[model samples]
Target: MRLVIARCSVDYAGRLSAHLPLATRLLMVKGDGSLLIHSDGGSYKPLNWMSPPCTLEVGVPDDDAREAGVDAVWTVTHKKTADRLTVSIHEVLHDSEHELGVDPGLQKDGVESHLQKLLAEQIERLGDGYRLVRREYMTAIGPVDILATDADGASVAVELKRRGDIDGVEQLTRYLELMNRDPLLAPVQGVFAAQEIKPQARTLAEDRGIRCVVLDYDDMRGVDSGVPTLF
Candidate 1:
């Protein structure tokens, strides 16, 4: 990971155009070939970022840019989308790189962890021929809760959440996008499974062609849910 604090201006070009006027910001270039520009103050979210599967080129500024006080320029281009994020540096305050090895990934809390385990055990709950590929399937960004295959043998990525919300859907979307890029998983599908799903999240998931599943925790564990059900 490389971190640089510099005075720079940023421009994003592609589906949309955006610009960040000259200012001092933190520029992060991760080992995965992604770049993120962040201001000192803001939510954890970066002011702007280029997702992985991208390339970065560093070059000296043009004559015009040099005359305008620009020192260097960094161009980041997305391999798939062709979107470009360009940063024109005026001055560098700090720069450093660190070699952080493989991450162990996030640890799920007890309930969420158990939910994943139960779902993996009852893989058929997804459908007639659904089979578990693996739990905590590692991806570039993070581990997908579960990776499975459906009746047709197509890849299915399941994201388990205690309560499904927009964020969970978004996370699953990212995983699906990345997975679909693989030739072996070209047509990967997504399932957002949770004990309860928010209406907004359900709508978003469906709009993206992802399926949603509500897991009955007790039933999966062979324990009574205590809610009356018609036999």
Candidate 2:
């Protein structure tokens, strides 16, 4: 079990790193509310917005509704200039044969990694806003995750985590403090990503202008399926 967990982490890290040629290192903030960013670099803008146009596509089984297989299919696609990222929510669907009956931690890991990839792609597409400045950055506090750049060279701090917990928020706050201290990161904003966010945390984040998002995972195959599908 331990080996499985380690392998999963390695695979996920490699996959994310490969997707970010322009980025140096990445971090993963766990559900405990602690952040896990890449040590290679820093963020591009102080306030990074994941605001890219997204399209959702649905799939239908057969003409006969009751006689088919999975009820629906969902595809989430994001576009930023020339770069595009697409994902099939159904791909993560766990069927009876491969029942991944596990805790939220294991399940959320896949979803969060997928989100991180798409986020990077979005940043890349919007090259005008920021560029992959370096792999690693040295801050007064410590080393940061991937760092990006705007035309003027300002930065935003992006922190990733599997779960959004108190620890995560506190860690993010620390990152924000470092950013605020740095003259280079003037006008920075913090971004927090995770599988799910508590309601209280949401309110706290709004109070701080920290963007807190619930990584909505799409389900199409089973009873727990998300977004309704269209045949």
Top candidate, metric lDDT: 1
lDDT of 2 by residue, 195-223 (tens): 67777776777677777755443321123
- TM-score, candidate 1, is 0.54
- The residue-level lDDT of candidate 2 at 34 comes to 26
* lDDT (C-alpha, whole model) for all candidates: 0.95, 0.46
Q: What is the TM-score of each candidate against the true structure?
A: 0.54, 0.40
Q: Report the lDDT tens digits of candidate 1 across residue range 179-220.
A: 999998879999999999999999999999999999988788
Candidate 2 deviant stretches above 4 angstroms: 1-115, 124-154, 216-226
| Clash totals, every prediction | 0, 38
